[model samples]
Structures are given as C-alpha cells and as structure tokens.
Target: MGPELPAALRAAVEALLEGASRKDLARRSAQVSNTYRGGGSSATAIVEDADATAYVLSRLPATYAAVAAALDEVRVAAPDFAPASLLDAGAGPGGASWAALEAWPRIAEARLLDASPVFLETARRLAAAGPAALAGAEMRRGDLTQPGEGWRAADLVVTSYALAEIPSERLEAAVRGLWAACAGVLVIVEPGTPAGTARVLAARELAMREGAMVLAPCAHQQACPLAAPDWCHFAQRLPRGRDHRLAKGADAPFEDEKHAYVALARPDVCRAAPAARVLSPPRAGKPGLEFRLCTPGGIERRFVARRDRAAYAAHRRLRWGDRVEDA
Candidate 1:
C-alpha cells in the first residue's frame, strides 16, 4: 500500500464529493486531462469549483504521494534541518504544503500561492479539515511567473508539478524568484517526461549558479552526465480511493505517479551529499545483481556477483530512488 491520506483530509474530500455528480466530474476530469496533455495551462483549465474538485479527486492522491516521496528524500538528505516557515509556490490544491507539513512538523507557518482563485479557495477548504498549521495557512492568489511583493521569505520553498505551466521564457526568472524567497531549501517537482526533465535540469543549473548545494537525486554539483534519451525521474505508487476511481473513470485500485525533482539547499544549511543515487531498479539474476547508479563520478553500471556475499546483500536492499554511499 502507498502512503495513506490523513483521516480528516479523506473526510474533507468525501464531503466535497457528496453533492457532485459523478458523470459531470468524470467529464470535467477528462477535459482537464486533455487540456494538460495538449500543453494548456491548468490555471485556465481549472476555473470552476466543480473543475477544481474534479482535479483534486483525480490528481491529488498521486500528487500528494509524489511530493511526500520527494520530501522523504529531502528529510534523509537533511536530517537535522527543520523549517518553521514554508512557501508553496504555484500550490494548486496545496498538496505540496500538505506533504511539506508531514515531512517537517516544525513548519508552523505556511503560505500557499497560486494564480487561480478557485484553486486557492478549494485549497483553503481542504486545509481547513487538515492539520492546524495547514488549516490556518495563508492563501494568496498571484501569478508565480511574475515577481510579487506580498510573499515573504521562508525557510523552505517548494513547487510541485507547477513549473511546466509557465512559459519557457519566464521559467528562469520564476525559478530565481522562488530561490530568492527561500532562506534554506528549495524543492521543485515535475512530471516524469523528457520535457519535465529538461525543466528540472534548467532549475538545477540555476540553483547551482546561485550558490545552492544539491541535496537530493544528484550526488555531485558537476554537470548532469546523463545524455539525451536518458533522463532522471522516479515513481511513487499511491492507493486509489473509491472517489478517485470514479473521478478518473478507472477501475484500478492504485496509481503510480512518476516525477522528476531536485532539492537544493542554501550553503548555510548543513546537508550531506550522497555518494550515489540509484537510477534504476536493481536487476537480480542467477549470477548476481546489476545496479545502475548516478554517482559523483558520473553514471556507472556496477555488477555484484553472488560470490561477493556482503556487497550483494547490501545491493539487494537498494531501490530505484535510494541513495547509497559506496555501492
């Protein structure tokens, strides 16, 4: 089973679905999916309350699972780091904020910013039934691509699956702005595709140029060694609720959300860079195991033979997203 939704959040979404027509929701969900697939902006696609609710029902679980998984990596990279304030940029239904709060309970203040009023309103409604910190979170409506004055600097800043919507020309500026508002760490997550990987790569370069240190996914600050046709991404499986199934018009009991993300911390923050990160699932054969990893040196394929009991046993425990020191 994947990460379960909190009881209050589950109830809140259920309540929203009570009066909603399944057929209407399914139609809207399809439209939203089509719009996204066609490269349209979600800020414009999700305009109505029903549209926003449909989006949450169909996308929230997977998004939350993805963000939560990424945040887990952040926790591992910076075990002693805790942020009291968080700024969730382009926070659609506040899934990133929810995940951030779960990862760092010390987050006492949260600010959620989005350009869509309906998304902001729905986020507020859903958060009202969640933890106190998130329930009392400040919701602000603004275009993330544009620099604004109302937003405050935070210890942690995160943007999940939001940068893809910004025009390519504005993405650099937006990323810089988010980094400027981050006093400690900045995390950005995007869909697991070539385009998404490209966006993350761009952000990674920008963060490095700003004197930020790599905190996750990458073990070194050197240029990404992966060439074209090979991009970095990870997957998280999440259980699908009845409402989720209905909204998505699918019978599957679970969903796997694949994403590409990077977590960068300011130099002042204490964080240890992993020696390597597993890039693919370890393949076990009669002879031994084959592991594909991204290390400080570059991409490497290591083979551990069955004769090497100690190394083989250790590599057996490794997963695709796991960080290893010497494997």
Candidate 2:
C-alpha cells in the first residue's frame, strides 16, 4: 500500500471510468452460504438482499469506500486497459457488474447472465436506474455451468464472488466460457482464502494460456510462467462503521470477503496515455459523483463525490440522470 502510483495507471483509470455504470451494486452472497444448505443465499433472497445492500451502498461515503477497494484490485491488475463491452458470469444481482460499470465509462453495454429470475429482475432494476444515461444493461437468465444459445464475446468479462458456487468439475468450463467471451479482457474475483486463492490462480493460468495477463498480486517471481501451482488472493478491510451498519441493519465491524483474483485480458482499447486531464469531484448536493481514469499498474481509481461539493455544481457533477436546460 506504500507504492507510488504510475502515470499509465492514471490514464488507464479515465478510459475505464468513461464506461462505468450509473449506480454502485453491492452484493453480500456470504449470507446465503452462512444460512443455507449450500452456504449460499436462495435466488429469491439473494435478489431481495441485493436490493437492500444496493440501497445501503448508495450512500456516498460507504459506497465510495467499497467501490475504491474493489477498483484498486482491478486497476492494479489490468492497468492501461479500457474495456468497451462487458459480460458478467453468474452475475447474481449484478453487484460486481454494476461495480465494473461504475468504474468504466459509456461501456457500450453489459450482459448479466444468471439462472435466477429474481436476480435477473433485480439486475434489470439496478441497471435501469444506473448512472450511464443509457437504457441500462442487457439481462440473460442462464447458468454459468451451462451457458447455452445466447452468448458472445465481450470487451470485459467478470465473475465476482460467484464461481465458488459451482462444483469443481464445472468451474473450469465457467472460467473458460468467460475467457472465450472476452475480446478485450477477462476479470474473475473470488473469496480471499487458500481454497479461493487456488481457484483464482488456476483460472489465471487458464486465461493466460489463452492470451490474458496477470495484472496484480504478483508479490512473487518463480519463473516466466508459474510451475506446479500458486495462489493469487488479496483482501481489503471493509470497516462497516455506523452509517452502513445502520442502513443494512447489521452490526458487522468489517467484512473479510476472503481472497480473490481480478485479471485483465485482450485489452479492447489502448489509450495508455490518452490525455493528461484531471477530473473534478462532484458538489456535495449533487445526486452522486464518480471519478475514474486509466493508470500504469493496470488498475483504476474511483470515488463518490464528497457531500460538500455537490451543492451548486450542476453541470460538472457526475451521476446517472440529470436534466439539462437548453439555452
């Protein structure tokens, strides 16, 4: 955490943020597994909980903190890359997908693939209310284990905190499908653990063989290509504090979502040093604000505007929808 950020890392963020989503989607799938037969939430409850979680995450400070941690991992791993389109595998309530959108800009579109009707419905709502000022992302209800028919390549592919649900046998295929669909890059995130780290490393090898690159958590150097096996997991301390705990009605001090890997592939566009522009944070009174751009370490930086800035800064503010008065 004491490293000085590079310049390329800076531009990589801008290009990415331009394609980010309108709203930040926060999901807590651990609740499902903690209280279910499979230790995962029911499709119905997952969707319901997503609604509550998203609402709480909408709060400026809380949302920004969560988004920053997630984006930091991504930026560090896939610096200087700006994805065009994105696909979410096992999208669930589209939490990770929404986060990706919030980090990128005008992202042509995003496809959410999940087998739960409830999750799909919730995804539609979240995307509909997204910040991009577009028609929201597309939704396709399908299982990652069996992604038949409607499927295609994407600029960016992400499967966050959902791959653990599939059995080991099918996990490979899901990862493969995600890689195959990535024309630009593929990113997969899982819990931070020995087991979780194993899966992430395994996926990293598979994707790299197919032309992807490891953007972060290297902290090692065995050889050109890792031999035998390894783990690529990083954890972020999510201090729940009061505002969020009160909003979610939970008393958790912090959340250790475990180890996970987020990698980049294809790199649909290359604007490593597109422009030296500084983005202004939003006014405190504005609905919301998100700031992002490309960077050197293959990662992006994002944040919701501090409240004090949104007051009277109308045009410069960043958010999903705002009416403009023609002169």
Candidate 3:
C-alpha cells in the first residue's frame, strides 16, 4: 500500500475542478498523457490553467504517492534528518512539496520551482489551503535545461519526474545544480520505465562522483547489479477518487505508480544503506518464501524454508519494494 493524498490537499484539488467541464478536462488529460508517453515534458503539455487543473485531477495523487514512498526511504536512511527547508524542483502543482511536508512536518520553509506558469499558479492555489509552510511557500518558474542562478541551499532537495525533460547534454549540469543546492539529502524520482531507471542511475553516478553517499536502494556504491532488460523500480499503489476517475476516464479504484528513485546525502552524512533490497514480489510456497534481492555482492535469489521457523516467521510478511538487512 502507498500513502494517500492528505485530506486538506484533496479537498483543495476537488475545489479546483469545480465549474470546469469534465469533457474538456478529460480531453486535456489525454493530450498530457500522450505527450508524456511520447517523451515530451509537462512544460509543453500543460500550457493552460485548465490543463494544469486536469493534471491535478488525474496525476497529483500518484505523483504524491511516489514521492512520499521515495522520501520514506530517505527517512529510513537518515532518521535524524529533520530538514527545516525544502526545495521542490520541477514541482507540478506542488505535489512533491505536499509529500515532503507530510514526511517532515517540522519543515518551516518550502520553495517550489517549475517551468510552467499554469502549474506554478495552480500549485499556489492548491497550497493556499495546505499546511502553513506550503501555503506561504515561494513559487518560482524556471526551466531545468537553463543554467540556474545558484539556488539557495536547502536541507532537502527533490526533483521528481523532471529530469527526463532535460536534454541529454544538459542533464549532468542540471544534476550538478540540484546537488549544489542540497544541504542534507537529495532525492530523485522518475517513472518506473527502463528509461527512467537509466536517468536515475546516471544521476546516482554523477552524485557519487561528486562525493555524495548512497543512502537507499543500494547498499554498496558499486555498479548496479541488475543488467539490461531488467531494471530497478518500485510500485506505490494509490487510491483514485471519483474526480480522479472521471478526469482520467477510468473505472479502476486505484492505480499503481511505478517509480525509480535514488536518495543520496552529503559525504559527511552517515551511511544507513540496507543489506539488500527486495527486487520483486516474494514467492510463497509450502516449503518457504523465495526472494529476489539486490545485495552488496550482486543480484541473488534466496529461499527461506519453512523448516527454518525463526527466519520464516521473521519474513512471512515481507513485501515487494521492502528493504531488508537480511535476505
């Protein structure tokens, strides 16, 4: 299961949909989806306020769930990380900011940056009814491909689903800017597709080369264990409400947002990497449970037989996307 959208945030989003034509919103939603599926970015797809509204109705919850899940791993790796300021780069309607506030309530300041004016204004509207920090947060419009004016350092910096939009040549510079602004932890989340995983891996490598420590997903900073045709990713299942269903023209009550992420900290930060990360759903059998894990050594499959009562009981409830010290 994944985290649900905060009640206040949900209500605010629903209010935005009021008086808008559902038919129009659905059409815009389709256009946005098609653009993204075709390797386009929201900067071009979400041009108008209505398009931004449609995005909130159709994608906000899932994006929030994915960011929250990725931030949870950051929390696990850095329990003492109590960030006071947050920077949500490429923030669309402030979903990542909301998710960050939920994870770190003590955060006193938030800054959202995006390339779309519609999304920035929509984010402000939605944040008006959100937590105090978010409601009064600064909203700025900036393109990721362009050189930033040296962003202020924040305790936590997140760029979710925005890296794919940068041209290949400019991506390294974009990541450098993000790392430059991060004071505590940096979390990068992308769609769960193989292409998304490749972006995350590239960022991970660049960050490490710049003296960043790997915090989650990988216990060791060695090369990714999973080879081509098999990429690293995780799923977060979020509930879809009536407005969400209507805007997306779907009947399903929920959607699984598959995401690839990397959480890294400054080299001075302590490392709390897991021993192994469960790569897929565990297989249950009369004998025991089978797990596919990414370990310090490499990708390996382990089986815990029922005869091993202690280990079996300890892992009976293990699920996919779970990090384990023993696998």
Candidate 4:
C-alpha cells in the first residue's frame, strides 16, 4: 500500500461523512462510476451538492493516493524541484491540490479550477480543514476544455483524472493550453485502462512537441513500447475508510487505484533519466527473477539468475514502477 491520507485531510473526510447518508452516497457513487466508465463527462455527472460530496467520499482517497505516488516519482526524477505555486486544473473536491501540497511544502500559492460550482464549493469546504495553504486556496469555476486568458502560470500544474472527461476532439487543445500554463512541470493522470493510457500517451506527445521533457514512466521520448494488447499503468493501494467502503459498496479493506500518468518538465530542468522503469512486478522463480523493463534501449525482458548472487540480491528489492540504473 502507498502512504495513508494526511491526518488533516482524513479528519476532514471523516467529518464530512459524519452527517452524510451512506445509502445515498453509495448509490450516487455507483452512478458516477458508471458514467465515467461509459465515457460520460463529469460536467453533468455531478449535478448536486450531494453528488459532489459522494464523489469526494468515494473517489478522493484513491485519486489522492495515485497522484501522490506519481509525484513521488517526479521527486525522484528531479529532487531539487521545490515548486512554489500550483495550478490544479479540474481540481475535483481539491484532491489533486491537497496531494500537491503534501508533495511540495514550498508551494505557497494554489489555484484550483473546475466547471462545477458544487464541486468547487465542496472543495472549498474540504480545504477549510486542510493545511493553511489550502485553507486560503484560490478556487475558480472554469471550463478547462476551453483556454482562457489571464490565468497565471504556476511552478507545478496537475490535472488528475480530469483529461479523460474532455471531449476527444478538444483534448489536444486542452493539453496544449495546460502546457502553456505550466512554468515548471505538468503532470497528467488518468485511469489505468487502455483509454486512460491512450490519453496519457497523446498528452506526452503534445508535451514533447511543446518542448517539455518526459520525467517519469518513460526513459526516452520515443514512441511507447507497449502495443495495443498492452497498456502502461501503475497501481497504488490505499486503505479504505469505513465511509469509503460503504460508499463504494466494497468489502475490501483497501482499494488499489490503477492509474496511468505522465510527468513533463521544462526543457531547462536538468535531471538524469532512469535507464529503465520496471513495468510490472518482478517474477521470482526457481531459476531467479525476471523483470519487464521499459528502457531507453526499448522494452526488454531481463532475467537475473540466482547464480548471479549480487545482481539477484539487488533485483529482489525491485517492484513495479521502480527506476533501475542497470538491467
């Protein structure tokens, strides 16, 4: 499992659930999930305050966990990146903003934009119980699919699980606009399905053309190695609170959020690229261990035999999404 929710955020969620109707929340959550799974837009999916609150209770934790994990990889790629400002486009319930604040304490200014007034209002209420930076966050109601002027560029820009909601025809323009608003790094995250991977891949290409460098999940700016039958994604497990379990109608104590994300930074940001990234869990066997790595050399299936004691020992510690210098 990944890191647990920050204390303040957890407390705030718990408080929100205190007076909420579990049954209604569960029903609404299911509806929202179905809508997204069917490629429906969220602009009308979350229509009421209750619907927005349900989304916060049911989906916020997983989204936060996924973004947090992605941000950790960003830190690994650029340790010196201490963003002073953040712009969370499509910041539903402000989950991405909270994750950004947790990842970069230096972030002093935060701007959250979403089209849904109810979501923005709920985000504000949730931010009230979060860190001081979020308590005074600038929440704006705007459509991210359309580019607007006068929005200040931030040191870090994040759009989590938001790109998939955009219409296919306008996605390229949206990606470009987000890149234009990014002064430092821009991270985009989506569901781990093939569709999600497609969005991330498309955005990656646009970012590269816009002069941004790939920072995670790819060792090179070349085409993706995985083909149609396969997609690139990672999973982060997070403990499910009682409210979350009830809202999702799940019996599992924890939920694994599978996500596809791409992190890109300004061309001037100097950082060493990982020789490869472990695409899946290392397989242990009688002979030794095998890993599927996405390397600068291309996709490779490497094996470290038990006879190679030192190499096998180091390989034992490897997990999915790890950056490897060798092998």
**Tens digits of lDDT, candidate 1, 1-327:** 468776777888888888888889989999999999899997668989999998988998888888888888888889888999999999998988988988897799999999989999999999998777899999998888786963579999999989999998999989889999999999999999999999999999998898989998898888899998989998888898887888888898998888999999998888865769889778989999988899888899999999999988888888888888874
Question: lDDT of each prediction vs. the true structure?
Answer: 0.88, 0.52, 0.89, 0.89
Give me the displacement of residue 104 in model 2, in angstroms. 1.2
Which one wins by TM-score: 2 or 3? 3
Task: Give each model a TM-score.
Answer: 0.97, 0.60, 0.97, 0.97
Better of 2 and 3 by lDDT: 3
Per-residue alpha-carbon lDDT of model 3 for 6-81, expressed as tens digits? Answer: 9999889879988999899989999999999998888679989999998898888999999999899888888888
* 72-159: candidate 4 lDDT, tens digit per residue: 9899898888899899899989988988898997789989998888899989989999777799899998888687752569899999
RMSD of 3: 1.3
Misplaced by over 4 Å in model 2 are 1-33, 36-70, 76-79, 133-135, 219-232, 239-256, 267-327
* Leading candidate by lDDT: 3
Q: Model 3, 151: alpha-carbon shift in Å?
A: 1.7
Each model's backbone clash number: 0, 63, 0, 0
**In model 2, which range of ten residues has the least summed lDDT?**
318-327
Model 3, position 155, has a per-residue lDDT of 92
Better of 1 and 2 by lDDT: 1
